[model samples]
Target chain A: MYVDMQTGTVETIMSNSDLPVVLIVEDEPDVAETYKLWLQEEYEVRMAQNGDEGLDLLDEAVDVVLLDRMMPGLSGDEVLERIRERDLGCRVAMVTAVEPDFDILEMGFDAYLSKPIRSEQLHETVDNLLDRSEYDSLLQEYYALVEKQATLEATKSSAELAESDQYDELTERVAEMRDQLSDTLGGIEDDSDFIATLRGLSEDDNN
Target chain B: MYDLTSVLEFDALSQIRPGSSILISGPAMSGKQRLAYDILADGIDGGDGAVVVTTGDGAGDVVEEFRSLVPDMNDAQLGVIDCRGDGGDQAVGNAHVHHVSSPGDLTGIGIGITKALEGLHNAGNERGRLALISLSTMLTYTDKKTVFKFCHVLSSRLDSAGYIGVFTIDSGAHDDQTLQVIKQAFDGMIDVRDAEGGGREARVLGLAGEPTDWQRI
Candidate 1:
């Protein structure tokens, strides 16, 4: 995903394949390290002690964030707001020790867990958030491919209607575009099914 | 007057009262979820309808955890809201399971709880129902003002419906200003922590028409 430096809208581009990354923002060293230990096996984990650091880490390839609610500078909530404002694609889950007040729930976090975090809850939240993010990314790629295919089809139909030498050249270009679109669409479908299978397996394992 | 000690000692958090909001505050890894599960399980075992809304964890994991503890909880009268998916609520056999994608989408949570309670009320059941979970995840994703508003709406709805509401919070997450705003909204507050030994301890910080005590759970 690429962020427009000025508008801050996320522009996602299709890639070959990449490992999901998790950004851990916590001032407490012990806590951050603990999350790293738990998540590193499945994800490429990155650490930041405060929100400012987390923002810097955001320049990297982060798919999800395990943000500590409290920190010395730029608290977790502040960082999250900035991320939303930038339209970052990264999912965030608040890891804190605050009571579950209704006010907190309305703030729009993906998930919340009180601190002294459980290994199970931590892993579950990260896995679910990452899976959701990946699914969303795949869906976007699928739509883009569909749009490209439709555009190519429209160009080809118009070229046929004209039946001129110039139109024939346009038809050749459209065919190439259609092949490319078909390849992209097929790849996305395969990825989507893989993600669905992963989700089903995880659910069954939990059960 | 109504044998307060027995109710406090034997009954789970949800059985304390109808339309009461109970705040279960504690540090992380303090077994808050376990306590919440136990309370819901107790209610289910007693044939009182219950709902568990999980923002961070999957409903299946929670169900599995409960099974690990009680073994017979699969047959219990409990409903779960997964709140992690976009479409359609699924019912596990007779129990209903709802999915929510974000913490901001708590309308689903409120609706699920309301439906459960209405069913119980229609059945002429006055034993009370429970909504157990946390809002910490929601608060972290949004701003303080939005969270405060969400809480106000939820508290008022639960209050009017007379359903038993218990939620956990992490004290270290909020500032004094934000904490005060939340404290004003709750009807009852139980401060839970690890005692000197291995067992848990709880102190009632505030309650409606009841004396406060800094005692153990």
Candidate 2:
């Protein structure tokens, strides 16, 4: 195997302006700007006045969505539904005044932070969601592989997995996904533990 | 021909091939981890870089145990992943010892494993091998699905790099379904058992061109 045993992490090619994009979709103008003020230094911030405007601003480029759950015209829940329907992979944190109830469990938002949000809570929610989002696709692929492996194990033998081309392709795809995620997340400073772990698992795919 | 390491020392397989993964499973007190260390020691002895990911013991303790078994072992030949962090204070403070946040942080553990492998590679060693000690401990931290996914990604990475990936698990700790799901990802299995005469015996299954007979270890 051809192994590149140099530095573990491939430095993320980053400029000052290349921060992760965050979209604030609060109907309240003051609240939206407050969020912008708090996050603009670290993230590329965008503001949408309402749900309709939020939908217009929504895209793959948006890394996170600070969604107000109860808006006047189009409710935050409806907008969240739309976001899910569109399969936009952006992390959504339901910023709401309503105390969380049993029904909130059915929602697809990555996090649910009640209203009167403190700066610390907001920052943490966004950061945690963003970090989770980095591995979302990889985790999906991993679960898919497990499901496939389970099905194969029930009907077939270990030799089959070793011999099957589909299995090999899935394995290769997973490795590539991990590498891609690791490469993308290589920028942030505090992920020293993560970077070190990635380096430990590194091996040459070309061989 | 590549040596099958301590496995060959026990059962004497002719050749097991690179890029193949093996599960060494037995009862709790069957010395499964010791067998894993022996395999890693063989790789190290052959000048193949070794990556030992410990989800159970601290790296220092693991290294100490390894040195006890193989007295000539050199620290340079091995890379350690200390996943069993006790929180607050750091367990390891060296380049060779990469610490993950915790055993529950599978993503961090994944990253640590890759980084350790890269370290071995940068050290000018070409043929690298990996060993993950005790999957049972990993099972304690997360759900079966997560652990299964971890193994899938990890084994796939090892396979693409043509590194022999070895892991140990207690056969009694998991149910049949769990064991079967975990076993599907590996190329073979070495089921070790304590014989009536007090010594241990092993049976190899699904390894490329290897015998499936129960051999005395």
Candidate 3:
């Protein structure tokens, strides 16, 4: 999928690359590097010390974000707010030492992982966020396919009604269009479910 | 059944009803969550089952609040699904309160709600007897479209299944457009504003087909 960073519009694109990208936005060099080391095997990892640098890396195909709550410049909350303002397509998990209070959770971090992070917690949070991102993308594709299918069904019904009206030549033309639309819609829907199931399986594997 | 008439200010909740989708809009310091707990507490005291899907708060916190509200209320009747821990099926006995890791997982939220409702129903509870308390933490991290769709699906399912769905919204955090969309989606809405003197006040906006027997807390 191709996401227009400026306009938050997502478009489907065929590309050879298949790895999901993860962006780590932590001010602490050691923490960011540790995350990179942990996640590099499964994802294309990128690191940014602050919110500004993280925003600069927004152009990359980032699927998940590991954000630190407290930073020297541009705190994690500020960075998250900016990311939302930009409508970036990445799931964020707030990694912090602060206790997971109601106020912190209410701030809208997808998942909250406290500092002194265990390898299991880090892996699970990243894996779940990626799974959700993929599922959301698949849902969008499914909705688009369903919309196309509904349009084709309507067109096909109209053509059948036209046939009853003795418009033989127009009926043939409409019938061809209907067939093409049905085939496209059916193929897209089938492919969408396949991809969605694949993503679900990958998520289960991580679990 | 307890006489709800004298227990609460009937005029305040005149717009609320059974099986209604209500948005308890308030500020962070305000008693939006407390009010939701009271509503569920009232249900449990009245022999109805309730399910709370916690997005921002922990199940223990919710249980503690309920305990404060109704100290003698049986914990068995109240189920809380905490989506704040690692994704696993951790139930607290018959209550069926499970822990979920992320708000981004709409599927998990949906599944948790389904399981909670089923548990309530299996315990001999009738339709219109279960209440859904979904704390609005997902609104901040997720996009408007995802939140809107999530609310849509949740409201639709609850309405069809005859469950009273009560959710919270932070008026200070969201824009006018998003707030308006959410208002249109719910069957009932309570605008909890700080009163001039002190405390808070709730204004009920009743949808066309909602019941007229909702009382104020």
Candidate 4:
């Protein structure tokens, strides 16, 4: 809605500096606009026509990127690789028409959305990405623990798992991680001491 | 939260709690997918997201078939793990559709389902249903042991994540061992087939307090 006709400058209607920025990197103009309309109210929404344009608009201020995988130039895959190489730290959701394959396991994106996304789907993806960005490090550890536990369970019988020392250790670590994650998630709503608490958690993770 | 009372739509299954898995086995083309889709539609109707892992049909076609039963369903309430590959890019308007390399690639399927589950969870849908359509196709591509291991991992994960799971298989295809391996992994089984008097019926097995008698469809 904040499009400057002459300069081709598109911005969210209400430019609230406090709101998180969401960049929509889609090749289809109509799709990009639809996403913009859906997200502009909650985020500082911006649109780029293709991969190159999307990269040009990328910055530290952008908290999330809804990238289309198969764009004309410098495809969304390339854009994602560049973003990771630059260590942008922004959460990238591959919003594309391509059906994901085993190649997706190697992709560096946070989330993937097939094309023709609905309004609520767009909103949910953005919100989820932002929530993840807030607790990035902690979530990684939590997920790792969960995966480890799953791996252990799948490889061992119930009697074997119950008697295994690795399972016991994993269970204890998982319990600790859950408690810490729950406490951290509770503090996310109140940003008063959020950064400080997050920093402390990250430091604890380092140790 | 992922209870079968909403998904199964049967008063008898109201006691089936969250985090339980059900196996729906029948002969080929006996409406196994239809039953699974009905379960999925029930979940969506109850405001829970639905994830469909299809080895048989394309993601779009699966969603289309689902719409035949639930006309007003939206893309926001659905996610698909499409295992069929025609070397063409397939994408639907609003649903989260992840594709695996091939039917034999259980790793690809696992990762795709995990991502879809996370997306639904992040969308604030703590309760959801995940349906793996037609284990027969999976068996065709991979060995029985591989399929069993993959199902074991997936079922265990779904159980712990508190999501209802509906898996379909062709009863006439697999041997007893194959069927038993999968049956041991699930909480219950529903065998669907032709009835004595020109109709289809489902008989629940292994679940407590349910009539062993076949119920008319």
Ranking by DockQ: 2, 4, 3, 1
Candidate 2: where are CA atoms >4 Å away?
A1-207, B9-12, B87-95, B209-211
Task: Give residue A46's lDDT in candidate 4 (0 to 100).
Answer: 82
> Candidate 1: where are CA atoms >4 Å away?
A1-207, B1-15, B67-76, B86-91, B118-126, B208-213
Docking class of 1: incorrect
- lDDT per residue as tens, model 1, A62-148: 778888898898988899889766656567788888656534434546667787788998987777666555544443343333334
Error of 4 at A54 (Å): 39
lDDT of 4 by residue, A1-207 (tens): 687899998876544488999998888888888888888888898889988888888887888899888878788888988876666677788876766763454455666778678888888778766765665556556556656676666667889988999889988987786567546544233211222223222223333
Cα deviation in Å at residue B122, candidate 3? 1.4
**What TM-score would each prediction reach against the true structure?**
0.45, 0.56, 0.48, 0.51
Model 4 regions lying over 4 Å from their true place: A1-207, B1-12
How displaced is residue A138 in candidate 2, in Å? 9.4
Who is ahead in lDDT, 1 or 2? 2
TM-score of chain A of 2: 0.61
* Per-model lDDT: 0.59, 0.70, 0.62, 0.72
Q: What residue runs in model 3 are displaced by over 4 Å at the alpha carbon?
A: A1-207, B1-17, B86-93, B127-136, B208-217
Weakest lDDT window of 10 consecutive positions for candidate 1 chain A: A187-196
Q: Score the docking of each candidate (DockQ).
A: 0.01, 0.11, 0.02, 0.02
